[model samples]
Target: MSTLYLLHKPYRMLSQFTDKQGRATLADVITVPDVYAAGRLDYDSEGLLLLSDDGELIHRISHPRHKQPKTYWVQVEGDISEAALKSLRQGITLKDGPTQPAKARQIAPPASAPRQPPIDPKRHPSTSWLELTISEGRNRQVRRMTAHVGFPTLRLIRTAIGPWQLDGLAPGEWRTETLHAPRPTDKHPNRRKAPRKDQRARPAAKHRKP
Candidate 1:
């Protein structure tokens, strides 16, 4: 049985346990030994972050190939247009490459926890909320995608990652849960083996240097 921690990472804090730049880190919040963050969030971003002692579980959660869905509450500047929402659903190209299609929709402002310092509304007088769910973990992908469609992300908070949700966790709080999901192994279970008949090769090709 592996232990997993559901942490509510506060805004402007690093996902790591230690930081050389004197910025706040998980050490300031969580004290569990031997548990490392399964995936990470940007220093400016907030919300659900998972930590686990199981490397396989971490790999399963973080690897893009797994296509584990992660959903966020995005606050973007200006009213997000339907055209933008359509493009987000269909997918958009970023500097790295094209992003996978995502679930994006305009939503009423979520009654989320207030930021530590609180976001300044004056910087962007007009803003709206969006619920965006994506499977790929690209560098600043949600922000880039929204910007490409003419709306820049003002704030981001991951609400859920696969089966884990941020529900009931306040800022700087954490809860532990033991996960038992078929016990992932390091072996490649999907590799195909050569057929027995194919393994028996011909003596030689007919026209070779006999």
Candidate 2:
């Protein structure tokens, strides 16, 4: 069995357990030993993060090759034009390359608690909320994509990762659950031959025969 935990990580907290600079880290919130974050949420961003002690499970969740979808609620510094939304859905070009098609749409402000240092309205007068889901995890991909569309992301929060969600979770809160599915097994290319009835090991001749 593996240990899995879902946490609502607050903004400005390091994803790892330690930071030499005395900054806040997961250790400050969770006390579980041997568990590590499956995927990372940047220190500047906040929301659902999965942790586990199982290496294979962690790879399944975090590896880009698996194509697990991650959903984020982003607040950008613009009114967010239709063209911009279309661009995101169609895939935005970044310095690395063109991104995969993403699911994006306008959304009302989330009902979550305000950020510790609330986004200063004076800094970004007009802002819009957008829900974007992407399968690929690039470094700062969401922020870069939004910026590519001419709307800088003011605040970003991941709400979902694959089948798990952050429902009812408050900042710095965590919950553990057993993995419902069986662990992944190695694939065998060649089929094994079954034993014939005569070849199979049979119970010793009945002693009753004597």
Candidate 3:
């Protein structure tokens, strides 16, 4: 059986479990043995991060080819123009290549906890909130894409990944969920295979920081 954990990652913390430089990381908060992050979130970004001891689940969640949707609540430095919003929805070209079309729209600010060190309005332009969802996972893709459309992202917080959501977990807090078997997806061609008894879920220990 695998243990799945949802972590509400805080801003400025590394996605990795360890850091030789001694910056905060999963190890600093989570004591779970053998669990690993399913994807990478930038140190500057915050929000939902999934962890699992099952390698297969990890692959399904992290692989861009699987096309799992990732949703973010972004605060950008400007009153985003309709043109920019349209550009984001239509897919903008980046240094890497043309990104896949994304679901994006202006939104009211989310009710999230105040960041430890608040974002400085002086250094940033007047900002607006946006809900952006992408099916591809790329290095700093949200930040890069927003910048490309002339509305630089001042803060990025992922709200959900695939079928899972943050579900109100506070910063540095974590909760566990169980997956009885791998849910069938387009990537799984052999859907007829029976799930192994060992693949069942179990209650996982909670890990949170004060």
**Candidate 1 deviates by what RMSD?**
15.5
Write the candidate numbers in order of decreasing TM-score: 3, 2, 1
| Overall lDDT per candidate, in order of appearance | 0.80, 0.81, 0.81
lDDT of 1 by residue, 1-210 (tens): 777788899999988876668998877777665667766899999999987666567766666566789999999999999999999999988889888899999999998888778668788889999999999998888999999999999899999998789996888888888867533343543432222221122232231210
| Residue pair clashes in candidate 2 | none
Each candidate structure's TM-score, on Cα atoms with residue i matched to residue i, is 0.86, 0.86, 0.87
Q: For candidate 3, write residues 64-103 as lDDT tens digits.
A: 6678899999999989888998999999999999999999
Q: What lDDT tens digits, residue by residue, belong to model 2 across residues 34-151? A: 6678778999999999977666677666665557889999999989988999999999789999999999999999898689999998988899999999999999999999999999
List candidate 3 stretches off by more than 4 Å. Answer: 184-210
Give stretches of model 2 more than 4 Å off.
183-210
Candidate 3 versus truth, CA RMSD in Å, comes to 5.6
Q: For model 3, where is the 10-residue window of minimal lDDT?
A: 192-201
Better of 1 and 3 by TM-score: 3
Scored by lDDT, model 2 comes in at 0.81
- Clash tally for model 1: 0
